[model samples]
Structure formats: structure tokens, C-alpha cells
Target: MLLDTYGRIATDLRVSLTDRCNLRCTYCMPEEGLQWLGKPDLLTDDEIVRMVRIAVTLLGVKDVRFTGGEPLLRPGVVGIVERCAALEPRPRMSLTTNGIGLARTAAALRDAGLNRVNVSLDTLRPDVFQTLTRRKRHDDVIRGLEAARDAGLTPVKVNTVLMRGINDDEAPELLQWALDHGYELRFIEQMPLDAQHGWQRDDMVTADEILTSLGGRFTLTPEPDAARGHAPAERWLVDGGPARVGVIASVTRPFCRACDRTRLTADGQIRNCLFAREESDLRGPLRDGAGDEEMAELWKKAMWGKKAGSGLDDPVAFQQPERPMSAIGG
Candidate 1:
């Protein structure tokens, strides 16, 4: 198991398929986008599948989430998912995408053994969406969400980041839209992951403010702490019934102590934490003909040195990761 000295075993693996994205979300990257990985730097389908197989069959990863600069942009994503599905003791599979091309691929991805999806959709208004993502493909995201639901991606999750003045006012409306559309909604506090390194704590929409804004329109009952487990999102029963909502307060209420996730960059570097300043290279050894056991031991050693927390509370000590959310595969 990928157990750290802090005793947090990482069973959830987030693999970045590429450092490429179609949309330029203001919080992720600049409008012109950042320098992308060279083709040779990215892991091929076989390499990705092999790593995932080792994580599941060898390191005991129970869940595998394919992330990216935008995973839908990966050419062999479907085939990759299909191959990973064939592994012994198959792990649960999902994707975190920007929802641009998902409209056309949802059904195919479902058939490829992808269990579900977590799409990024900040607002229901096209104008606001365009402003936030700096893309006019708002309708495409809507279509993608509808397609995922139609394709039987149960409990389709919508990840919304509430920026202070940008789309913070849409919190209630976003939740209402998700509820009406039968999608699970999660509000994530904006962290210091932007490429511009322009994140300001005062400008962020905290979890408390989110609940307060939504309280004006709907009632939210807190879900039990035990029910949260290692998940980052602290959930709530929306209106005291079947429908529910979640808030991932990474800035204010960090969940580092229970983090079970380990990230693999598009170039195959192991990131024990999202805000980690260091990485362990797996691609180099793999291309050098390292065996599976050797690579797995390297991964184990990386996790064993993970820090206890992200250190966000100490502004002076908490330096923004050199790599932005795009390169880091949020």
C-alpha cells in the first residue's frame, strides 16, 4: 500500500492523461494557455494502462480517476479506459473533464467501463460561463452534462468553483440547476493553484459563505462527519431529503490528514499531494526498462514522504506550487 509516515494510505490514484486543455478557465491558466508537454513527454496508452494496472493489482488502489488539462482532449482515452477495465480486481474508473467533447463521447466512454464523471460547470448562464472559462462553449458543457446523464453516468457530479466576484452570486442558482437536472453538485473553495499565482484569500468564496448564500434560497443539513471518510467534499442533505450538495473547503478546512489520493502527472511524476513542491519520476525508470516491482517501490517511497498538511494556513510558508492547476491535473 502507498502509506505515508502520517499513516494515510493512498488508494485513490489521479492520473493526468495530458497537459492540454481546450478551455482557458481564469482560475486554471492564462487565456493564451501555458506551455504544454511535448508529445514524447506524455505517457502512451500502454504506459498509462500498465501504471494503472500496477497501482490496482500491486499497490492496492481501489479507485482510478483519469484527469487532464482536459482528459477529453486525449485521443486514446476510450481505449485506455477499456484496457484498464480489463485488469484483474478492476478498480472503479471515472474522469474529471471540462465537458467540451464529452457530448459526443459520453456513451462510448460508458461502454468503455468508465463508471461516472465529474464535469466542471460554474454557471448556468452562457455569458457568465464564457467570462469564467474565456470560452463560448457553454452550450457544449450543457450538452455534455445532458449526454452523461443520458448515457447512464449515475450521480453525475458537477464541480463548481466559487470565485469572489466572478460567479459567486450564482451559488444558489447553480445548486438549483444541478438539483433540477438530477446531478450531484459540489462547491470547491478556490485555492492557490492558478497559473498566474494571483490567488488572494480575501477574494475567495469560502465554504461558509457558500452555505450562507444558499441558505437564503434553500435549507442545507450537514451530513455526518463519519460519512465523509477520505473524501474532500463535506456533504449536506439538501432540503433534508434525497437531493444533496457538497463543499470541498480546501482553503479553510483542509482534509490533508485523511487524503487518500496520489497524483501522477502527464509525464509520469508521482505527486503525493496536490500542492507538493517535489515529484518522483516514474517515466524515466519505466523507459529505462525498470520492472513493475521497482517502479511500485519508487511510488511507495514517494508517498511515505508526503507532508502532513498543505500548509495553506501559514500564508508566508505556503508557496503556490510552481505548476498550476492545469499542469498538476486538478
Candidate 2:
């Protein structure tokens, strides 16, 4: 396994296939969207496969999560999933998507070897969704969720980004929706990854608030300490049922100490952390015919420099990453 300076093992890899997205959530991007990289600049399927090969074969990575402005927006996405699934000693593979096209793509993607999925759904209210995403595809996303479940992506995960004055009030309702529909609901504390850089600590509904609110609605109990292990989200059993909910306290309780994932941007830069400011470019070397060993070393060198945390713990010193969540992959 690849060990960072802090003794943490790097076993999870999140790859961004493209920076282009189909929606413009108020907190993630502008309504018009950002200028995307040209086709020539994005990593080709072969290049992405090669990177994953190195991460799994050489670095001992075990899980590969594909992300994007919308991974479904990438043409041949199923092909990409098929390639990753074919890796020797294949890693556990999954995808994080907005679910707009999930209704149409989930089955093919599952057949292509995707393990599970996380769909972003901040609000169940269509009006709020349009206000948040500046788009009218709320029903499409819902259909996507249903498609995912019916396609055998059981216990489909719904990621809800809770903004204090925005959709925070829907937390209880969202969790109930997930419980009733059999999707695992997870509340993510809003972070400063927006392109606008207008993220404020007060605007975030803390994990404590989420737990309290959830407890008010159901007999929520923290998933046993043993159950947590290295998973980023802190889980809790709902009404002691098989169904459960999770909260990723990125803002209030950074899980950096247990983080095992790193990211590869669509433009071919390696990011050690989601909030990492510096990125190491691998595209230059890859295009110059650098072999797998050379690329692996560059990756090792970059990861060996991993910090103890993302710096949110030190509010005075914390700085948001230069890239928005979409460009860096959600």
C-alpha cells in the first residue's frame, strides 16, 4: 500500500472524467456554468485506465470512485466503467453523479460493473430544486434514483448538501424519504469548494444539528464505533432498522485523519486532498510517453507529501481549493 508521510494508507482514488456538468447548483457553480476544457485537454479513456491500473496494481489502491461535473455527461462512460471493472485484482468501483441521466444509464452502467451509486439530491421540493440548480430536471433526477434501485444498485445513496438557510429544513423529510424508499441518506456539511468562494461557516448546518434533528424524528443511534472504521461519513442506524443515514461533517468535523482518497482532475492533475491548493500535473509526462513506473513515482511523490489535515480545523489558516467541486470532481 502507498503510505503517506502521516502513516495513512492511500487506497481510494476518485477520478474526474470531465469538468462539464449538466446542472448549475447554486453552491457548486454559476447558472451559466464555467468554461470547460477543450476535448484535446481532457484525459482519454486509455489514459484514465492507465492511471487506475497504476493506482491499483502499484499503489495497492482498492476502491475507485468516478466523479465529474456529471460523469454521465461523459460519452462512453459505460466503456470507462467497463475498463475499470476489468482491472486485474479489480478494485471496488462506484460513481458519484447528479442522477439527471441515471434513469437511462444506470442499467447499462451496472452491467458495466459499477458497484453502487451516490446521487446528489438536496431537496425533494421541485421548486426548491429549480431554485437551487437553476434547472427543471428534478423529476429526471428522481427517475434516476428509481432507475438506480431497480437496476440493482440497492441501498442507493442520496447525498444531501445542507445549506443553513437553503435546504437544511428538509433534513428530516429527506431522511424519511430515503428510509421509505430504501436509499441511504447522507447529509454533507457544506464546504468552501464553490467557485464563488462565498461559503460561510454560519451558513452551514453542523453535523451536531443534523444528528439532533434526525434524533428528533427517529430513534437514531450512532453506528457502532467498529462500524465506522475508515468510512468518511459517520453513520447511524435509523429506528434500529436495516436502513441508516450518514453525515459527513466536512466543515465542522473534518474526517481528514481517516481520509484515504485522492483525486485526479479531468485535466490530469493529482490532488492529494479535496481542499489541496497545489496540484501535480501528470498530463505533461503522460503525453511525453512516460511509462507506468514513472507515472507511479510522480504519484507517490505527490501523495508522500500529504498533510495531516485539510486545514479546516485551523479556520484562521484554512483556504479553499482553487477549483470548484465540479472541476475537482464531487
Candidate 3:
């Protein structure tokens, strides 16, 4: 396994296929969106396949998740997934999506070898959805969730970013709704990764606040630690429900100690941490015909230099990454 200096193993790789998104989520991107990278700057489908192959075969990566500005927006998404599925000792394949286009693509994605999905949904109310995403197709995301479920992506996880006054009070409703539909819910504390620099530490609804809201509605008990170390969310069981709810308290509670993941940007830079100030250029090396051994060393070297944790909890030294959430491939 690839080990960092702090003795953490690197086994999960999140690869971003593109930096283009259809929705203009207020928390994720600017209303106008970004000037996307041109095609040539992106890693070709073949390049992505080769890198993942090296990570799995040489570097001992076991989980491969595709994230993006919106992964489903990429034209070659299915092909990219197919390549990962073909890996020897096939890694668990997954994706994190906004679910706007998932209604049409979910089945194809599953058929192409995606094992599961985590869909980002802030609100079930149409008006609230429109307010958060600045989009009119709230029902489309719902339909996409249905499609993914029907395609055998069971226990479909919902990632909801919570704000102090916006949707924070909906914890019970969201939890009950998720349990009712057999969906697992995870509430993420709003972080300072927004494109518009609108994130205020005071505005974030913390994990404690979410649990407090749920506590008033139902009996919740903390789930045990995951067998695989350092799961991002803290899990809990609803007293009478079959499905579970979780919270990724990234801002208030950091889990950098057990992070076994690294990230690959759509344009081919490798990031050891989501909030990393520096990136290792893999595109140049790959294009120059670097062998797997060489490329793997680059990845290993990068991981070796990783910081202890995302130092967001430190008020005096904390600095938000230069790239916004969309560019960073959450």
C-alpha cells in the first residue's frame, strides 16, 4: 500500500472527469458558472484509464470514485467507468453527482459498472430547491434518484449541505423522507469552499445542530466506527427506521488523520488533500511517456508530503484553498 509520512495508507482515488456543471448551485458555483477547461487540457479517456490502472495495480487503491463539476455531464463518463470496471481485482466504483442528468444516465452508469451513488440534494421542496440551485428542475433530481434506485443502487446516499437558517431545520423531514424511501442521508456542515466566498463560519449549521434537530424528532444512536478506517461521516441509527443518517462535520470536526484518499483533477493535476495549496502535475509526465513506475512514484511522493489534516479548525492559520468547491472535485 502507498503510505504517507504520517503512516496513513492511500487507497481511495477520486478522479474528476470534467469541470463543467449544468446547475448553478449557490453554495458550489457562481450563478454564472466558470470558464471551463478546454478539451486538450483534460486527461483523455485513455489517460484516465491508465492512471486508475496504475493506482489499483501498483499503488493498492481499492476504491475509485468519479467526481466532477458534474460527472454525469462528461460525454465519456460511461466509457471511463467501464475501464475502471475492467481493472484486475476491480475496485469498488462509485460517483458523487448533483443528479440533474441522472434520470437519463443512472441506469447506463450502473450497467457500465458503477456500484453506487451519492446524490446531492438540499431540499425536497421545489421552491427551496430552486432557491439553492437556481434551477427549475427539482423534480428531475427526484426522478434521477428513483432511476438510480431502480437500477439497483440501493441505500443511495443523499449529501445535503446544511446552512444555519436554510434547510437546517429540515433535518427531521429529510431523515424521515430518506428512511421512508430507503435512502441513507448525510448532512454536510457547510464549509468555506464556495465559489462566491459567501461562506461564513457563523453561517454554517454544525453537526451538533443537525443532531439536535433530529434528536427532537426521533431517537438517534451513534453507529459504530466503520471497519474501514476514517469514514468521512459520523453514522447514527433512527430509532424506528431501517435506514441510517450521517453528518460530515468537516469544518467543525476534521477527519484528516485517517483520510486514505487522494484526488485527480479533470485537467490532470493530482491533489493529496482537498484543501491542498499545491498540486502535482501528472498530465505533463503522462504525455511525456512516463511509465507506471514513474507515475506511481509521483503519486507516492505527493502523498508523502501531505499535511497532518485539513487545518480548517485552526482559526489563526486557516486559509481557504484558492480553488472553489467545483474546481476541487468534492
Candidate 4:
């Protein structure tokens, strides 16, 4: 197990396939985009699979999520999912995509052993979508979500980030839309992860504000903490019953004590925390002919030094990581 001195064990792994994305969301990057990873710097497909193999077989990682600047943009992404799915004591697998190409590949991805998908979508309005993402592909994202659901990607989750004076007013409408479509809606607070370093605490929409907005339209009953267990989102039963909504208050309500996730960058560096300042290089040693046990040891050591919290609580002391959310594999 990837155990830390704080008595936390990391069983979930987020592997960034590439730092390249098709959309330039204002919250994520500049419109022109940051410099992408050189092909030589990215881990090869084999290396990625081998690392996952070690984590699942040796380190007890039970859940694997492939993220990226946009994971669907990665070449042979389906093949990577297929390879990872073949491991013994198979881990549950999912993808976090911007949903640009998902319509065309969701079925293939599902067939390739991907369990489900979490698509990033901020608004249902086309003009607002374009403004937020700097892309005119709102229709494509809708098509992609439909494709994901139709392809048997059960419990298709939608990840939405509300920016103040932007799409923050659409929370209730978004949740209502999600419930009508059988998709799980998760509203996340905007964090200081943008490349522009322009995020302000006042500019972010808090979880309380979201629930308050929804309260005007519907009743929300909180789900028990046991049901949430290590999950980032604190859920609520909408209008009472099976259908529920979630809010990931990473900023206002940090869930660090029960954190069970470890991250691997596209370049094969281990990130024990999303807001971490340092990374452990596994690619260097892997390319140097390191064995499975050695690689696993490196991963364990990285998690062993995991931070107690994301440190976003202290405004003065908390420094944003040099890498943006895209580069750091949000």
C-alpha cells in the first residue's frame, strides 16, 4: 500500500496521459495555450501500462482514472485502457475528458474496458460555453455526453466549475438538467490552478452558494458521510430520493484527512498531492532499466511524503504550484 506517515493509504491513481488539450478553458489555460510536453518527455504507452501494473499488482491501487489536458486527445488512448484493463485483480477504470472527441470514441472506450467517464462542462448555453472554454463546441460536448450514456458508461458524471460573474448563476439549472438526463452532477469550486494565476477567493463560487442557489429551485438533503467515504464530493439527495447532486468544495471544505488519491504526471512524475510543490521522477529510472519492485518502491516513497493538506486554507502562505492544472493533471 502507498502509506504515508499521516496514516493515509492511496488506493486511487490519476495518470495523466498527455498535457495536450483541444480546448482552452479560461479557468485552465491561456487561449494560446501553454507549451505542451515534447513527445520525448511523455511516457510511452508501455511505460504508462507498466507503472499502472505495478501500482495495481504491488502497491494496492484499486481505482485508476486517466486524466489529461484532455485524455481523449492522447494517441491510442483506447489501447492504453485496454492494456490496463488486462491486469490481474483488475482495477476500476475511468476517463476524465473535455468531451470533444468522446462522441466518436465513447463506445470504443467502453468496449476497451473503461468503466465510465467524467466530462467537464460548465454551462448548457452555447454562448456561455464558448465564452468559458474559448471554443464553439457546446454541441459536441452534448453529443459526447449522450454518446457516453448510450454507450453504457453508467452513471456518467458531469464536472462543472462555477466562476463568479460567469456561469455561477446556472447551478440550479445545470443540476436540473443533469437530473433530467440521468447524469450525476458535481459542482466544483474554482481553485487557484489556472495558468494565468488570476484566481481570487472572492471570484470563486462556494459550495454554500451553490446549495443556496439550488435551494431556491429544489430541496437538497445531505447524504451521510459513510456514503461519501474518501470521495471529494459531498452529495445531497435532490427532492429526496435516488437522484442526487454533489459539490466538491476543494477550497471551502478540504477533504485532506481522508484523501486516498495519488497522481502521476504525463512525464511520469509522481504527485502525492494536487497542490504539491514537488514531484518524484519515475520516468528517469524506468528508462534506466529499473525493475518493477524498484519502481513500486519509488512510488511508495513518494506517497509516504504526502502533505497533510492542500494548504489552500491560508491565503498568505499558500502558493500556487508552478504547474497549472493542465500540466499537473487535474
Candidate 5:
């Protein structure tokens, strides 16, 4: 197994299929639209599959998550999912989507071997939704979530980014909605990924505030395993029903101490830290006819170099990377 010096096993891989997205979220991309990675710069389906195989076989990876500016925008997303599902041990595969095009592809993705889906829906209010996403398809996203449920994507997760002055007030309402609809609602604290937009710590809403607002009506049971990987979410289940709620406290409560995730860009560069500028390019070597064993060694070296924590709290030490969240594949 690929073990890092910090004793973190490299088991989960988050792949960004493309940097292009339909919606220009206020917190993600610029209002004027942003430049996207070139076609040749992004890894092809075959290359992505090759990398996944290496990760699974050599690193003991048991889970694979597809993400992007919007992974659904990828031409052969279903095909990729199908390939991942066909692996020997068949890792638990999932996808993170904006839910804009989900209504059309939910069934195809489910049939292609997707275990679950997480939809980004910041606000329930139409105006707020448009304001947050810079798109007027709030209803479309809602329908997409329903379609996912109908397609048998159990425990459909709704990811809500809680920006203090933006959508923090709607936390209780969102949790109640998720509980009613049987969707796992997750509230994520905003981070400083988009350096161009000028992220501020004061704008964040802590997890404590969110739990306190629940009024102690439901008992919160923590799921320790949820903190095992790069999953920033701290999971908990409500008293009744199968409904669960999670909080991704990146800002107020960092999970860097137990982070077991490593990301691969669409172009095949392995990133140890999302906020770090360093990356090991795997696409070039793979294309240059590097053998599987050689690639495995390269991966081991990269994994062994992982730091103890992201150190996002250190102002002098923490210098934000150039890539935005869209390019980095949240």
C-alpha cells in the first residue's frame, strides 16, 4: 500500500474530468467568466483510467470520486464511471456535481456504476440561488436532485457553502429540508481557495454556530470514519430516520491533521495540498511510455513527500496557489 511518512494511506483519489463548467458561481469563478484549461492540457479518458488503476493496485485505493468545474460536462463521464466500476475490487465510486445537467444523466451515471452523488445547492431561494451561482436554473437543480433520488441514488447529498452574510441564515431551513426529503445536507465553511476573489476569515460561519442553531432538538452522533479521507465533512445522523447531516469546517475547524486525500488534476498532476503550488506531473511520463512499475515508484515518492498538515492558518507560510476551485476540482 502507498503509505505516506505521516502514516496516511493514499486510498481515495479525486479526479477532475474538466475545468469547464456551465454555471459561474460567485465564489468559484469570476463574473466575467474565466479561462479554462486547454483540451490537450487535460488528461484523456484512457489516461485517467490508467492513473486510477495505478492508484488502486499500488496505493490500495478503495474509493474514487469524480469532480470538476462540473464533471457532468465531461463528454464520456458515464464511460469513465463504468470503467472505474469494472475494476477488480471495484472501489466505491462517487461524483460531485453542480446538478445543472444531472436531470439528463442521473440514470446513465447510476447505471454506469456511480454509488452516490453530491449536489451543490447553496440556497433554496431563487434570487439567492441566482445570485450565488450566477445562473437562473435553481428549479433545474432542484429537479436534478429529485431525479437523482428517483434514479436510486440513495442518500443524495446536498452541499451548501455557508457564507456568513450570504446564506448562513438559511442553515436551519436547509437542514430541515434535507431531513424532510431524506437528503444528507452538508454545510461547508468557506476557504481561501480563490485568491483573486479575496477570501476573508470573518465571512465564515463556524460549525458550532450551525449546531447551536439546531436548538438541541436532535442528537448529533459523529461518524469517525468520515474524517479518514480528504472528505472535509464531519458526519452526524439525526435522531430519527436515515437522514444524516455533515459539516465541512475547513476554516474554523481544520481536518488537516487526519487528511488522507490526494488529488489528481485532469492533466494528471498529483497534488498533495489543494492550496500548495507544488505538483508532480504524471501525464508527461505516462505519455513518454513509462511502465506501470515505474509509474508506481513515482507515485510512492510523491505520496511519501506529503506534509503533516496544509498549514492554511499560517499567514506567512500559507501562500495561495494560482489555480481556482474550478480548476482544482473541489
Candidate 6:
């Protein structure tokens, strides 16, 4: 098992397949998106599969999550899922998507051994969705959700990033919708990932406020979280349905203490922390003929340097390396 200096086991790995996405979500991307990662810098599918194998076989990684500016944007993403699923003791494989392309790829993804998917949909209102994403794809996203369900992606999860004046009022409505459709709904507190994106603490809607707004309409039971990684969300089940809800209080109640996730960007850099300024580049070494053993050593060096946790709430927080959240695979 690869344990970092802070004693956090490397059990979960989030790999970004690409830095390109189809939507321009206000929270994630700027109106004018940042420059994209050059093709030469991005890791090939073979390289990604090799790295994932090493992570699961040598590093004791138990779960593998595929993310991206939009993972579905990556050609042959289903092939990557197939390779990850073939591991000796198959690691739990999942994907996080914007759900724009799920309508066409959900079945293929499930057949390729993807265990689950988490879709990002911040609002149910078409105008609100357009306002938040700068695109009118609310109906498309909804269709993607239904398609995923029809494809046997049960308990499909919808992730909503709640901003104070933007979509906070729709919290109860979203929760009710999730319950009605047997989907898992999660409300995430906004974070300060992009300074240019106007992330303000004052604009965040705390998890407590979200729970209070529900107002005993449904009994909230804390679900058992025996998983090893730090997801930050305190999960609960809404009574009278198979649906569930989660609250990710990143801004108000940080879960850095138990953070066990390591992100591998599409360009092959390992990020020990989301807010970290330092990243160890593996793409250059891999492309230049580095063997798996050599790459494994580099991985250790990066993991060993991880801080106990990121103090993002600190008034004196340092500037994150200029990589936008899209490039970092959120």
C-alpha cells in the first residue's frame, strides 16, 4: 500500500482523460475558456491504462474514477474503462460527467465495466441552467439522465453546486425531484478554485442551510460510510424512496483531514491536493521511455510530499498553480 507522509492511503485515483469539455459552466470555466492543453502534452490511452494498472497493482488503489473537462469527450474512453475493470481484484470503476453526451454513451460505458456515473446538473429550470452554463442544454442533460437510467445506471447521481443567489432556492425542488426519480442528489458548497471565476465565500450556501431548508419533509438518515477515501459529503437517505442525498461542505466544513484522493491530470501530472501549487509531471518521463518501475518511483516521490491537508480556508492561502479546474479535472 502506498501511504503518504500524512499516513493517508492512496486508495482512490481520479484520472482526467482530456481537458476539453462541451459546456461552459460558470463555476468551472471562464466565459472565455482558458487555453487548452496541447495534444503532445496529454497522455495517451495506453499510458493512462499502464499508470492505472500500476496504481491498482503496486499502490493498493481500490477505486478508480474517470473525470475530465468531460471524460466522455475522450475517444475510446470505454476502452479505458474496460482495461481498468480487468484488474486482478477489480477496482471499483466510476465516471464523473457533465451528462451532455451520456445519452449516446451510457450503455457503452456500462458494458465497458463502468460501475456508476455522477452527472453535474445545478438547476432544473431551463433558463437557470442556461444562465449557469452559458448554454441551453438543460433538456439535453435531463435526457442524458434518463438515458443513463434506462441503460441500467441505477440510482444515478446528480451533482449540484449551490451558490447563494443562483440555485440555492431550487435545493428543495432538486431534492424532491431526486426522490421522485430515485436518483441520488448532491449539493456541493462552492469553492475558490478559480480566482477569475468570481468564487466568494459570501456567495456559498452552507450544507446546514441546505438541510434546514428541507425542513423535515423527509427523514434524513446518515448512511454508513465505510469507504476509505475522503469524499467530504455526509450522505443521507430520504425516507419513502430509494433515492439519497449528499452534502459536500468543502468551503464550510472541509474534509482535508481524511483526503485520500490523488488526481492524475490528462497531461500526466500527479496532483496530491486540489489546491496544491506543486504537481509532478509524469508525461514527459513516460513519453521519453520511462519504464513502469521508474514511473512508480516518481509517483512515490509525489505522494510522499503531500501535506496533511490543504488549508484552503486560511486567509493567507497561497495562489493555486495557474491551472484552471477544467485542466485539473475538477
Candidates in order: C-alpha RMSD to true structure:
0.8, 1.0, 1.2, 0.7, 2.0, 1.9
TM-scores for every predicted model: 0.99, 0.98, 0.97, 0.99, 0.94, 0.94
Please give the distance, in angstroms, between residue 109's alpha carbon in candidate 2 and its true position after superposition.
0.5
Ranking by lDDT: 4, 1, 2, 3, 6, 5
- How far does residue 244 in candidate 5 sit from its true spot (Å)? 2.2
| Model 5 lowest lDDT segment of ten | 221-230
Clashing pairs in 4: none
The worst-scoring run of ten residues by lDDT in candidate 2 lies at: 28-37
Model 2 misplacement above 4 A: none
lDDT of 5 by residue, 192-268 (tens): 87726587666667788888766456777676684434677887767753567888887667777777777999878
Pick out the ten consecutive residues of candidate 3 with the lowest summed lDDT: 221-230
Tell how far residue 71 is off in model 6, in angstroms: 0.8
Per-residue lDDT for 1-330 in model 1, tens only? 999999999999999999899998898889984788999999989999999998999999999999999999999999999999999999999999988898999999999999999999988889988998888999999999999999997779999998777788999999989889999999999889988998998898999999999999998999899989999999999988689999999999998888999999999999999999999999999999999999999999999999999999787888889999888887
Candidate 4, residues 219-257, lDDT tens digits: the string is: 999999999999999999999869989999999999999
- At residue 12, what lDDT does model 5 achieve? 79
Off by over 4 Å in 5: 216-231, 240-242
Which candidate leads the pack in lDDT?
4
Clashes found in each candidate (C-alpha, N, C closer than 3 A): 0, 0, 0, 0, 0, 0
TM-score result, candidate 5 = 0.94
Error of 6 at 90 (Å): 1.9
Instruction: Please give, for residues 1-330, the per-residue lDDT of candidate 2 as tens digits.
Output: 667988998898999999988899889988774778899999999999999999999989999999998999999899989988999989998899999999989999999999999999999999999989999999999999999999997669999987777788888899999888989999998889988888888777899998888877899878886898888899988888778899999878888888898889999999999999999999999999999999999999999999999999888888898899988986
Residue 61 C-alpha lDDT in model 3: 95
With candidate 4 superimposed using the best TM-score fit, by how many Å does residue 257's alpha carbon deviate from the native?
0.2
Compared with the true structure, all predictions reach lDDT values of 0.92, 0.90, 0.88, 0.94, 0.84, 0.84
Q: State candidate 6's TM-score.
A: 0.94
Q: Tens digit of lDDT per residue, candidate 3, span 32-82?
A: 847778999999999999999999999999999899889998889999998
Count of clashes in candidate 6: 0
